[model samples]
Target: MTAMSLGPAYSRLWTATALSNLGDGIRSAALPLLAASMSTDPVIVAGVAVAGQLPWLLLGLIAGALVDRFDQRRLVVLVDCGRTALLAALTVAVLTGSATVAWIYAIAFACGVGETLRDTATATLLPPLVNDADLERANGRLVNAEVAGNELIGPPVGGYLFGVAMVLPIAINGGTLALAAALIFSLPSVFAPAPTSESKGRIWSETMAGLRWLVRSRRMFTLSLLSGTFAFVDSMWFVVLVLFVQQILELPAAIYGLLVGIGAVGGLIGGFLAARIVRLLGPAPTLTTCLLAAAAGQLMLGLASEVVLAALGLAATSAAFGVWIVVARTQRQRSTPRDLLGRVTSASTTVVMTASPLGALVGGLIGREYGLRAAILLGVPALVIAACLAYAVLRERREPAP
Candidate 1:
């Protein structure tokens, strides 16, 4: 399906996603740079990163339950506005030279709360806006926008802005988030999630319901595990990646952003091709391929001795990640009941995101003690296990009972 065929609502959502993600990319790159400059301690730097994701582990389930009860569109708008305000405050802190590692950590944690809420609400909000049949294509387009803004354009711009002034990227990030909030607020109220019986349940019960649903479904549960594994490895690799590029690869900080942007090129290509690949090869085989490809990419990255080879490895890994996300998310959306989408998405996200901080901590310690390359190499084994799981679980076609 063409982009236009997805309707104006999806387009608006897509645009807003891109805008916010652009800001996300900027902040993501800048935060690490800021932390690294302040202290060369890998664990300290990783702590800054870890704080941002900790909310996912702490508040993820509660946020999901809340999303199911509220107006999802409004929730997203409010969350974006909150994030904008948070960044604006951070900008001020940075400008006044009052920003300490602890201050940055607090702000990152608050923003991550917004991220958790906004993500759950958006996943629940999308189904009403697009046709079920176009779910994969629509998801792919959204992924495309996310990669373009967060990875391709955001990183390089953030890196440049950081060199100009530390506060510039943070300030600009707030502005982009503000714009994203406005866009989301503009959408019609028809975008609201339909109320269901679960809405009346207690928060704890409602949260449990989502977990129960996921556990009952072998496919979703398996996929969630695989996703969590991938998240762990990805987080580990990225936490130490800045150090790798600077110390091991002998590249400047500016070039690090460029390398991430190059990796995004692969993400963009994968996002555009995901739906088509799923159509051509079917979801199972396609997912299997993505897993194996990611494993290969990680292996290449771990073993690379030069910038050119490292870039290729990053690109290949990103491509696999992009496609895997679209396919897996599309499948989840398709399999899930509409009323439970928010909670289910939250449960899944919580599971996946919980791995991130743990991975970050491990990566930091390992990178500090062993080597940056050793930290990256850790992902190779995880990906290989994930690939094996994918093949075993997803390869067979189960015919429906007549």
Candidate 2:
């Protein structure tokens, strides 16, 4: 398929992702607020955050193997359906006044499992749907859509809805999952079967092979490590941001949503412009530059005292990270073989995701011990380390002439 020919399918996929991600963003804010409303302990609220991501660390490999062995579209549909059902159940529990933190934790874990399945399948399915030449563009579009959904639409809506009724965000999240499932069902049947493997091997053996290849590739290894570090530091910011808004800046509850939404504007712009930037600077330079920009943004956030200044810094950081994500993901998608894509992506996701809970734990502890400002300032080093790693791993390279 030529790049132009792949446009329609890419559009369909991007739309579905954007819709689902909006729901994800709503849940991201709502869940924590729900926990906070129920309990005053920072540790417990952080635990809710940790539970949501725990599946990625534990079941990611298994999820990848399943994506490789089954129909990717069916897996996506099933996972989406499962999430919808789970969220609906939570909504019922909340409406009945029976919802507890434990219930939230269980639902969060289940949703995480579904997310793992959907993500692994999507990563594997994308390359085959688009032409090789269009992979970068497709990735950029998808990333941009995610930014719009998660950063732009979801957070602010979640805060407002939570103020009205806790069940509202959960219901909305459920509805979106159902819609996403319907979209997945409409995907072409070409993605039904896994690619042929030369050797018939057990799931464990195949999983090991995938992990080995990822670890053995110098560039892949470095990317995975940097990505994991990035996830950790970013998660720290996530945990502290709300507290910072409420406690330090003394901003209204609505500002949390507004600031996050504003920051998402950067992601939207980055996603839209990623392809052109890639063309101009080539992938390596683009990746390195964005990482450095993200580091600078994080540092600025740490230094800023005023809410507006902090939001600006965050917006810049988010935009830079958005572009960096597009560049790195495109490079990985272009470089990896189709058959190995699911496994490798899952492995990388597993590593990076593991860092999130750890970062949350550290952030919670640090915030409890010191202050939100201090906890946030600690993230600066992680960003710096990530930038340096990217620079070391991805040196300058010539761009292909159009």
What are the lDDT figures for the candidates, one per model?
0.83, 0.79
Q: Which runs of model 2 end up more than 4 angstroms from their true locations? A: 1-6, 29-47, 88-103, 162-168, 193-201, 236-258, 305-309, 361-388, 396-402
Candidate 2 lDDT over residue span 1-402, tens digit each: 222356666666766787788998899889989989899999999887678788887899877777777788888888899899999999999999999999988988888788888878887778777777777778877887677777677888998999999899999999998988887787777776554754555888878878887877778777788777777877787788888888778889898878877777877778767878888987777777777777777777777778878888788777877777777777778766666777888988888777877888898999899888777778776676667777777763422211
**What overall lDDT, based on C-alpha atoms, would model 2 receive against the true structure?**
0.79
lDDT of 1 by residue, 233-274 (tens): 888888888888888888899878877878778888888899
Evaluate residue 31 in candidate 1 and report its C-alpha lDDT on the 0 to 100 scale: 85
Best by lDDT: 1
Q: TM-score for model 1? A: 0.83
How close is every model to the real structure, measured as TM-score?
0.83, 0.82
